[model samples]
Target: MWRSGSDAGAIAIGVVVEVPTPGTAVKHPEALGADLWRTDEPDLDEPRTGIRLQEIRLTSQEGFLPRVVVKADLALSSASIITMPNGTVFPLDATQANAMERLWGLTTSQSLPALPGASEGQRKLMSHYRRERSNTLRLKKLAEVRARHGKCVCALCGIDDSSKYPRQLSERIFEVHHLLPLATAATPVRTTLDDLVVLCASCHRAVHATSAVEDNYAVLAGHLRGES
Candidate 1:
C-alpha cells in the first residue's frame, strides 16, 4: 500500500570526498608519493572527511522535470576526487572541475571545514527528495505485481506481512522499493511495474540502510532464498 511519497525524483546533494587531514603539515603532492589512498586516513592534523554539496541549482523545464546542476567551482579542497552514493570514487572530470570553479566565483569566499564523523541524521542530509510516482501508478503497479506473484511478500526475504502480523496492521507493513538507486535519476521517468519490488518494513529498511543489499538486490534475494 502506498503510504507516502515516491523515490522517483530523489537527488543526491552531498557526497563524501577524501581530503588531507586538517592541521597536518602540508606535503607537496609529489612528495606524498604515488599512493594517494594512504593519505585518506586521519593523521595528526585533519580528522574529518569532506562532505561537499554537488547540486547547486534547479531549473524547471517545459515538458520535463526540473534540471539539477552541480556547482561549477568548489570552495573546499582543490582535490578533484568525489565519492558517490554507490561508493564509486573518481577524480572530477574537466567539465566538473570547470563547473566547480565557476560556482566558487559566484559564491562568497568561505572556508570549507572538514565534516564531523557521519551520524545517521547527518548522512540523510546528503539526499534531497523531489519527484515521485503518482498514487494511481503506484497502486496499479502493486496490483500487477501481486497478480504475477500470486501474493504480496517481501522480495528480499520472502516474508509475507499479511500472515505474520495482525490483519488490520499487516497490509500496511509492506512497502514497494525502487530497484534502481533513486539518486541516479537526474530527470523524471516513468517507473515501470518491473522497477519495483514488494518488501516488508524491516527488510526494506535493511536494503536501504546497508550497502550490501542496496548495491545488488538480486544477489541479496538469492542469498535469502538459499540459492547463493
Candidate 2:
C-alpha cells in the first residue's frame, strides 16, 4: 500500500512511515513498473518486499506463531502468507513488528547487517550480510524486516502507527535516505543500515522543518534509538 507526494519541506531522514496499504504503487512500463504486481519473478522491482521474521524456528507463544513471518511494504503482496513446520500457514504480510530488535530477533543468531549502534568495524562486517535479494525471503524472514523498520519508523502527524500500536503496515511511499550516503566520501564509515531510514515524505519533511536544515540527510543522530 504505497502513496505519493514527497514532503516538500521540513523533513528529516526518510520515514521509518508505516503505512497499511494506503495507496497503490502506481504502474508504469519501464523497469519495475511493468512487473510491479508479480512476486517471485526474480526481478519485479515493485519494491522488493522485505519481511520481518520472529524466528524461522523459535517461540512457544500463542497467536500467529509459526516460527516465521514476513512484512512487506506492499499492501497486498503474497509474501505475507507464511508456512510453518506443521503445514499450518498464517497470512500476515500486512503485519508490523514490535521493534527493530524484534525483527532482528527473527534472524539466525549469527552476524547480520549492523544495527544503528554497531561499531565502525562491525558496520563493515555486517555490510557483508546486507544483501538486496529478490524473491528469496520466506515467511519468517519477511516478519523480521517489518519488526526492525517498525521500531525506528518516523513519527507521523495526527496519528502515528507506533509498534504494537497496530498489527501490520503496508509499504507506503517511504523514501530511502542514505545516512552513510551511497555516494560521497564525507559519509560516516560506521553508519549502519539502521542509520538510514525509510520514512514517509511528510515525516521526512517534518524532521527537516523541525531541525531547520537544508540537506536531505536524516541526521537522526539525536533521534530516539527506538520506536517514536
Candidate 3:
C-alpha cells in the first residue's frame, strides 16, 4: 500500500506478483446484496476446494491496473530481487542483508477459499499438501510476518486486532487477507507480505466469500492500505 502516515507522501516499494485480467475477476457478495459468510450460521466445516497457487497467471487484467506494490522480499527469494526502471526495488535496499522490518500486524488465525456448503476440514482433505503439517500457520505466515512487523490490524474489516480476546472462535483471531485474491493471482498486485494482511478470520472470509463470478475490485482497493 502507499504509506499513509508521517511519511505519507513517500513512495513505498513492493514485490510485483501477477496481474489481473478479464478472465480472473471476483464478485462481491455485498455488492449483489448477499451475506458472504452467513454470520448467523458460521460453517466451520465449509470446504475450500482447489489449489489457488497453481493458477498464478495473468490473462484477464489488462486495464485493471498498470502496476502494484508489495512489502518486499529480502530473504529466501533475495536472488530474484532486481533494480526497477525507476531505480527503486521493493524495500528499496540492495546494499544491505535485510531491507527493513515489515510494517504490518501479526496473528495465527487462518482462512480458506469458501466453496458453498463445503467444510474447512473437507477442503484440507482435498488439498495437495498435508494440511496437518502446519497448514494453518504455513498458509497464513506471510501475512503474519507483515502483521508482526507493522501494526496489528484487520486487513479485511479495516479494524485493528490489538484487543485481546477471551479465547473464543467468535471473539478474536488476527488474520492477513490477500488484496488481489491470490487464488487467481492475475490482478497486477504485488506479493510482498505487505500486500496481504492481519485480518480476522471472519473478515477474511468476507473477502473471497463474495461470489464465484467477477473479482471484487473495491475490496482490493481498500484491503492492503494499512501495511508497510
Candidate 4:
C-alpha cells in the first residue's frame, strides 16, 4: 500500500511492504534485508520496471506495516510503480485512487525475529524458528558437498571431520560459509549451492574474524599450514 495527499498529481511519499501473512508481526524488520524500489514505468505484465530511485531499505517501529525510510526525502514519481521484496510490484497513478493488486505473484516467506518483552518460552520459540531456517539451508549444502566428495572436509584447513571424530560429532565440525556475505548484500539475492563453501568451525571463525578473507581463502589456508 502507498500514501498520497489530495493533489492532482500526488507524489507517493511512502509505500508499505506488507508481511507475507498480513498482520503477521515482525519484531526486527532490519533482519529481513528487504529493499523497496520506485519505477516510473512499470510493466504490469512483467516483473521488470524502469527504476526511478535507488533501492531503499525498509524499517519498522515494532508495529503492523513497516514504513520506508530513506536518507534523503525521496518521493515516488506520478504514475510510478513500486517494487518490493518477494517479487511484489505495485503500479500507482497519482491522479487515480491508489488501487493495487499483487502482480507477478510469487510465494512469500517471512522470517521474524524474537518479539520484544517476550516470555522465555516465546524467546525459545523464535530462537528455534531462526535455527531451523538456517539449519535447513546448511544441511542441504552439506549434503551436496558430501555427495560429491564422500566426506565433509573444511575447504580452508582441509580437516576431514569423519576421520578425526565420531560419526555423530564429525558432522558438527563442518559449517557452510557464504562466499558473498549476506549481511553486505544491497538487495535480496538468490543463494545457490555454488555460493556456499564448507569450512571447519575453526576456519570459519577465522575467516569471519579477518577482513578480506573471503576473497582470498588461500591467505587463511596458508596461515593454517603455518606458512604465514
Candidate 5:
C-alpha cells in the first residue's frame, strides 16, 4: 500500500479472513461489513471464497497532514502491525503468523480494479476499527503510566492496587480510564500520559454511572473527597 501513491496522507491496512458460510459450524464471527470480493472475477486463479485485504488511503491535495485517522482491529486476524513514517512500530499480535502467511499467498498476486473511494461497507468496518483503535491507544498510554509509577492506583480514590490485593489479583482488578472519550473528539487526537487515570473496576463503573460524570477524573476525585 505504501507504493500506491506519493500523495498518500493516511492509510488503513488490515488482513482479511473468510467468514463461515451458512450451515457451517461458526469459527470466527462474521467480519461484519468486510470488503468482500467476487470469486468469479478474472483476478482469481480459481473459484473459491475470497478474502481481500482492505486498504483506505487519503491522497489529500492539501499537503501533508500532521495526523490522519487510521483504524484497525487485530482481533479479526492477530497478525498485523502498524508502522508509522517516523519508523516507530506498533506490534499488535504475533499469534496469527501462519494464517497471515496463507492469506499473503492468496492475495499477493490478485490485482484489484481501481475505485474512486472507500465503499459503504468498507466505511462501516472502518468505523468499527476506529473505535477499537481508540481503546487500544488509550490502554497503551495507560501501560506507560504503570511502567513509570510501578503499579496501578485509583487516581480519584488514591487506593493503590498493591496495597489492597495480592500482586496477581491486584493487576487484574485495575482498569485504565480515559479522561476524554475518543467518540467526543472532533479530530484525530494523540493520547498522552496526562489524559489517562488508573481506577479500580468499582471506581471505573461509578465514574461512568451518570451522564454528568463527563469522563473527568478530577470531578470524580472531588466527589469522592466530599468536595464536589
Candidate 6:
C-alpha cells in the first residue's frame, strides 16, 4: 500500500514493500536508482499525471524492515513511470525525461530529408542543448550578480531597470549574455562567471542583431553611446 502526504510545499510518498522469502537476494529500495523508483500503485489521479519532479528525498523508517519515504518537489503519477523489459515499472527521472525528449526529436526528424548544410536533427539537438544549458547558466549568473552588486545592470547600455520598474519586472528585462557561443565549443567546456555579461533586453537584442555583433562588444557600445 502507498500513502501520500504533503507538508510545507513538499509531497511525500510512503512505499511499503513486502519482504521476500528468506535467502532470496533483494536490493534495498533506496539502492534501486538514485533518480527513479518503482511504485505499485497505478490508479492514481489520472488528470494530474506527468508533473516534472525537480528533486526527491528518500528516507528509511527507523525500525526493522524499514519502509521507504519519498519526498518530491512535486506530486508524482504512475503515468510517469516506465515499464522495464522484466515488466517492472519505474518512475522516469527528470534527466531521463529530457534525454527521451531529445531522442523523440531525432526520431521524428528521421522522416524528413536532411538540409544542405545542417540537418534538421542536428539543428534541433543543438538548439535544445544550448537552450537548456543557457537557461541554467542564466539563473546562476543572475543570482551571483544580484548577490554581489545588489542589482543587475546592463554592462553595455548602463541601464538599471530596477530603478525604473518593479523588481520582478526589472529582472525580466535583464538577460545573461554569453561571451562565447555555446555551439563553438568542440567539447563540453566549463562555464565561468567571466564568460557571462548582464545586458538589458534592448542591448541584448542589439548585441545579437548579427553574428558579427557578438564579437564586437566595443563597437556595439560605441554605437549605443552615439560615438563615431
Candidate 6 lDDT, tens digit per residue, 21-47? 222233322222222224553322222
lDDT for each residue of candidate 3 in 1-228, tens digit (9 for 90 to 100): 223333221222233333332222322211211222235633433322222231111222211111222224434134222333233223434433232222111122367667688564321111131111122433455446545755455544555444554435322366545544545643323344445555566666655566541254355535556432
Clash count for candidate 3 is 35
- TM-score for candidate 6, please give it: 0.44
Candidates sorted by lDDT, descending order?
6, 1, 5, 4, 3, 2
Q: Rank the candidates by TM-score, best first.
A: 6, 4, 1, 5, 3, 2
| Residue pair clashes in candidate 4 | none
Model 5 gets an lDDT of: 0.50
Prediction 4 global C-alpha lDDT: 0.50
Instruction: Tell me the whole-model lDDT of each prediction, alpha carbons only.
Output: 0.51, 0.33, 0.36, 0.50, 0.50, 0.51
Off by over 4 Å in 4: 1-134, 211-218, 225-227
Question: Among all windows of ten consecutive residues in candidate 6, which has the lowest summed lDDT?
Answer: 62-71
For candidate 5, the TM-score is 0.39
Candidate 4 RMSD computed on C-alpha atoms after optimal superposition onto the true structure? 16.4
Candidate 1: lDDT of 47? Answer: 46
Q: Tell me how many clashing residue pairs each candidate has.
A: 12, 41, 35, 0, 0, 0
True-vs-predicted CA distance for residue 129, candidate 5, Å: 9.5
Stretches of model 2 off by over 4 angstroms after superposition: 1-145, 148-152, 155-170, 186-192, 205-228
- Tens digits of per-residue lDDT for model 2 on 1-228? 111122111111122223332123422122232233445544333233222222221223212222222233233223323223223223342243322223334334545676687544221112111222222222223334458654434433322345334445534434434444333433214333454545555656655664334243334433333332
C-alpha TM-score for every candidate: 0.40, 0.22, 0.28, 0.42, 0.39, 0.44
Candidate 4 residue-wise lDDT, 182-223, digit = tens:
766665465667888999988888887866766557678788
Q: Alpha-carbon error at 81 in model 1, in Å?
A: 49
